[model samples]
Target: MITRRDFMKFVGGGFASAMALGGYAFAFEPLARLNVTRYALTPPGWTPGLKLRVVALADIHACEPWVSASRIASICRQANDLGGDITVLLGDYATGMNFVTRYIHSSEWSKALAILQAPLGVHAVMGNHDWWEDKTAQRNGGGTTFAHRALSDVGINVYSNRAIRLEKDGRGFWLAGLEDQRALIAGKKWKRKHIQGLDDLDGTLAQVGDSDPVILLAHEPDIFPRVPTRVALTLSGHTHGGQVRFLGHSPMVPSRFGDRYAYGHVIEDDRTLIISGGLGCSIGPIRFGVPPEIVVVDLG
Candidate 1:
């Protein structure tokens, strides 16, 4: 028992709802929301009498209107207020979208990030965009990318297959950062399939000279499965919560494993990985369901 007028009304309501959702995804969520997500965990074999607070920012994709220097500075201030023992920049300071009003220079974004402070100082790792955007680096296939230079020039310690031992209040832990796994857009030959990478997890972990628990920083969570249990934690970004998530599931994740490492806390075979939803857009200026977030980890 359906009337034509009632059916028309139903269709109109559906159309309006669609438009509203589109507006929110395209405009509001990407530009308006910023959340602080915290995790407190005592990883297996964590050092006793040692506590560390880590504040991390990832996938800035800095650009006009979408992710501005002002916004970055504000994010820095807020992150500093969280009182982290160390602050880490998880990368992708370059613009991710093709459609943008104007591009923000690398120096501008890095300068904004320079304000982030911590007792252990600010450390950084380059993301895929950081490597891909540097035309010269890609052409050479082995040179310092602009993103690395930008972060380094600003006094941030950028790691590449390196590990450093950091001490807090008398206890110690090793902090390691792996080079981006997809540094080369043009994949290199690896048997039948082409592969992209600069990451060296085994070599990096080898640099650890002690039995101290390790906290690894990698730009993409794809390396999670390979991470050893000896490392207490791994922090990563790059998926941006698949850019559009719904009901805790992302249909289109950029990782090879799909939603397996799309976002948030992940534990596999006793190893731990924490992936940030990230603070900016990628591919397009849009976000739905998954809003931008800063991650804080308190480890003991």
Candidate 2:
């Protein structure tokens, strides 16, 4: 027979123990790696003579519990195995400021990033997280001037409103990257800002010639409405496709237009957009229906 006080003490102790266990389970539970998703998008003027395999990975918020260097390397290795003609990385390479300056600075993270390689070259753009956290400063050893040199050093072409052309099998296509719309909006008032506008697309396209096929690399899918029809296809990732989805439905999305821009491929008019669910978590540590992804887009 226990006194009331003793019973209450026992209950509190059990509750505390359960909470501790729960916390550990939530943090250290084995991360479930996901299968790569493949899709085909045939844009207008896409030459039948060109058969290209392009692999795109995005929104890898490489933080602890969800994404580590080893995990990112594994994903890269798998992509490499797929024998893609080119690999494109949409942004959010590092989780945030604290994670980049702290956890991701470890040797494992560096080693993981080193594993990312592709034949035609790996191109990328900055995500809202990368731009907002002042990684440009981290790149220059303390000054916000597009400091993604770390990624560049590891063979990634970090493009901001820029274009590069890839020639394959005697045919060529233009790959262009735009600064994230959020970053552009946030830095609108500043002069000499890193952010750029959709107007820059005209100049980027000019370099590749108007008739050439062009694939635009942008981080946020919301920018879809702003892209010109001259762009054959656009690839983005920033939604995480509602990381913790249920019953094949996303419970929440952060876009201003609600669920209209939830996830996967959305084509309007002549422009084809592929939105990757991304390869890591954001805002939380769990992913249910929305598993991470490596998108392979076949262009023929």
Candidate 3:
């Protein structure tokens, strides 16, 4: 019973409502809600009474109009205030996407992340973005060195297929840092042989004790399955919580593992993997259901 004019008005109103909702998703929610989630995990070698807090901050794509250097520093301060025993940075320091990619220096991000404090130490591992120049540029291999130097210069031990032993309050365990798997694959494809050290997981784990509980630091969650059973937990970030989630599932997860291990805690038999939603954006600076975050894991 509606006239053509009335129908057009209804259509226009629906379009306007949709645009408003899109604006909130693209602009409001991404910047407003920064979440910090706490998880309680008991690894095999963890002492009964001692609680070790490990804070992880990932994907700090320090770019303009979305993530600034000041914001990075603020994020570090927040993580430090959490009183963590150790802090791990999962990398993506430079901004992504060809749209207005600001060449925010690696040192700028390191200076911000160095503000983080932990009793044990602050460690970092490179992300795929760190190995590549930009979303579209040809891979030349200098980005990895630049990224590592920046963090190392600031005293954040950047690891590539490396393991370190830590003794805290009479309890000792091992931590292994693995390089970004995508970078490894790309290197192999391009016949680049210099970066083989980063992908050597077996060599890195060879130093750990057989019975000691180990925590592995991997930037991408896709590496979770390859981790051995000796490793009690693996910390990762790269999917960005699918960057957008609808009805508790993300349609565009970048993993071959698909939605099975997109975000949050996932248990596969005896091994537990915790994937951070990460703090920045790639492709586009828009996050819908997923908010930027830092993850705090307490090992009891």
Candidate 4:
């Protein structure tokens, strides 16, 4: 019954199965290494009165197999160490699909929020993922509300089409957050219908005055063109900078404006936009060239 030929076939099949499992394990291994790349932005007309160093982390997509609580804690620690006056979390915190529940159960997200500390404060906004996740719970009326409450408990100020004025060293600036474009485009029946209307940057700036530099925190970088002239700088993180960019270039960019807005800073007219590559991956768990980042803007 134990012929040499049959035994060989059995061993070969077992080896193939083992190899397949090993490959799967290896594919997801890099996600465990949570490293946040840091970048600095200094605008030309910035005044030295504030000397504010703002640290921004966006597109966290906190879920299993990608970003973990331990990893998020480490990122928070690093931001604290940098000693920035303010820390801004751009949106897409959850995957908002089948993985939405996974984000809900993420202990790392809660832990990460607890560790976030800044001299001024921490602020955030919702992204496309937030809408997608909430839409799933339209009938139950619990999904989006739960996410909002969870983030609030963590002390992150989620600004949806709103602005908060901040004063430092006798100098003042405005921080504004806009509703995600995806939600607006999805129309009235969208589950996250509460997140209607785009942010009125001009209206918000009117309250603060034109002289004061306004900093906008929008989830999707595509909103850059819509930003008003008074907005000196805008921070965003929806693209994940083409998560799997090849040879220093992304395969495809979903933005209407094309590849120029794929990643990093872009100066158009008098306004400046900085897009973070983000701290997590989407679709596949691999990050070949596009690494996660934490952007630092020195306004002096």
* Best-to-worst lDDT order: 1, 3, 2, 4
Best to worst by TM-score, what's the order? 1, 3, 2, 4
Off by over 4 Å in 1: 187-195
Per-residue lDDT for 188-286 in model 1, tens only? 422314447899999999999999999999999989889989999999999999989989999999888999999999988888899999999988899
After superposition, candidate 4 runs with Cα above 4 Å error: 1-36, 96-108, 136-144, 184-203
Model 2: per-residue Cα lDDT at residue 292 = 80
Query: Mind giving the per-residue lDDT tens digits that candidate 2 earns over 150-201?
Result: 6766666778778877889888888998766655323333343544333255
Span of 10 residues, lowest total lDDT, candidate 1 = 186-195
Better of 1 and 4 by lDDT: 1
lDDT of 4 by residue, 92-169 (tens): 777643432255453347557678898799887877766555655444532343445667887778776788788888
Each model's number of backbone clashes?
0, 2, 0, 1
Q: Which stretches of candidate 2 lie over 4 Å from their true place?
A: 1-30, 97-102, 106-111, 135-147, 184-199
lDDT of candidates 1 onward, in order: 0.91, 0.73, 0.81, 0.71
Q: Highest lDDT, which number?
A: 1
